[model samples]
Target: MAKVFFTSDHHFGHKLIIDFESRPFADVAQMNESMIASWNTVVAPEDKVFHLGDFSFLNKEDTSSIVARLNGYKTLILGNHDRGRSRNWWLETGFHEVSEYPIIYKDFFFLSHEPMYMNKHMPYVNVHGHIHGQKYEGKNHFNICVEHWDYRPLSFEQIRDSVVVSEEG
Candidate 1:
C-alpha cells in the first residue's frame, strides 16, 4: 500500500503570501521554488498526497507546471481562492479529484482549507491548512502548513504526534 501525506496552502509564486501572516520568504519565485523543492524532497513517486487548497498563484500555466513537477498522486480540497482559471489548471494537471469540502480518510476529516469555525462537535479530528502555524501561537488543534515531508501518505498516527490537541469542553 502507498503511504499518504497531507498538506495545504503552498501559495506558490505569490510573493505577498508570506507577508499576509508574517511568513518569512524573500520573494514570490523564491517561495515557489522552495515549496516545490521541499515537496519533491519528501514525497515519493507512488505516494498519495492530499493538498488542502490555495496551491498556487493566479497563473494557470504556472500552476500546472508546478503541479506536474511535484511527486505522488494528488487530491485537492478546493480553497476559497481555488476557482476560475486555477480550477481549470488543476484539472489539466491530473489531480485525483477536487472538492469543496472535507474527505474522510480512516475516520479523520481532511479539508483543503481550515473551517472558519471548527465545530468541536465533530467526532473526528479536523486536519486542514489555510491558517499558518505561527498564527495559532501555542494553541493546539491546527497544524501549520507543511510544504513537504519525506514520508508519502502520512497516517493519522503521524499527524497526531505533531499536533497539539486541547481537551474537549
Candidate 2:
C-alpha cells in the first residue's frame, strides 16, 4: 500500500538556511540534490506527502522543477514564508493540494506549518514544521521538520508510533 508521509521546512534553494540551520551541506546544490534523493529513497510515486510549510524559497519555475522531480502526491500547508504565492499558483506549480491554513487529519492530527498550542488537556496531536532545529516539548507536539527527521519524509505510522513511545516512556 502507498504510505502517507509528513515533512516540511525544505527551504529548497535557500542557501542561507544551510548556515542558519547548521545543515552539513557544503553548498545549496549539494543540499538540494541530497534532500531530493533522500525524499525519493523512501517516498514512492503513489505515496501521499503532506509538507507542513517553508517548502521552497525559489521562484515558481525553479520550485516547480524541483517538485516535478520529487516522488509522491504532494500537498502543502502554507507557512509564514509561503505567502508570496496564491493557492491556485501553488496548485499550478505542482502541489496536488494547497491549504492556506491548518488542517486536521485522522480526526486527531492538527497539521500546521507552525506548532499549535497543544497541551495534555487537548486530545489532538499537533504535527507541524517551520521551527527548523528548535522543537516543542510535549507528547502532543510532533515536529516534522527535515532537520529532525534526517531530511527525509516520515510516514504516518512512524509519527504515531513515536507519540505512543513518548507517552509510555
Write the residue-wise lDDT of candidate 2 on 1-169 in tens digits: 9999999999999999999999989999999999999999999999999999998889899999999999999999999889787898889889999999999999878999999887678888999998999979888999999998899999999998999898999
Local distance difference test scores for all models: 0.66, 0.93
TM-score of predicted structure 2 = 0.97
The window of 10 residues in a row where model 1 has the poorest summed lDDT is 147-156
Clashes of each: 8, 0
Per-residue alpha-carbon lDDT of candidate 1 for residues 65-155, written as tens digits (9 for 90 to 100):
8888898888898876675545556777667677766777776554447744455566555676666544443323445365333212345
Candidate 2 regions exceeding 4 Å error are none
User: Over the full model, what C-alpha lDDT does candidate 1 score relative to the true structure?
Assistant: 0.66
- Quote the positional error of residue 113 for candidate 2 in Å: 0.5
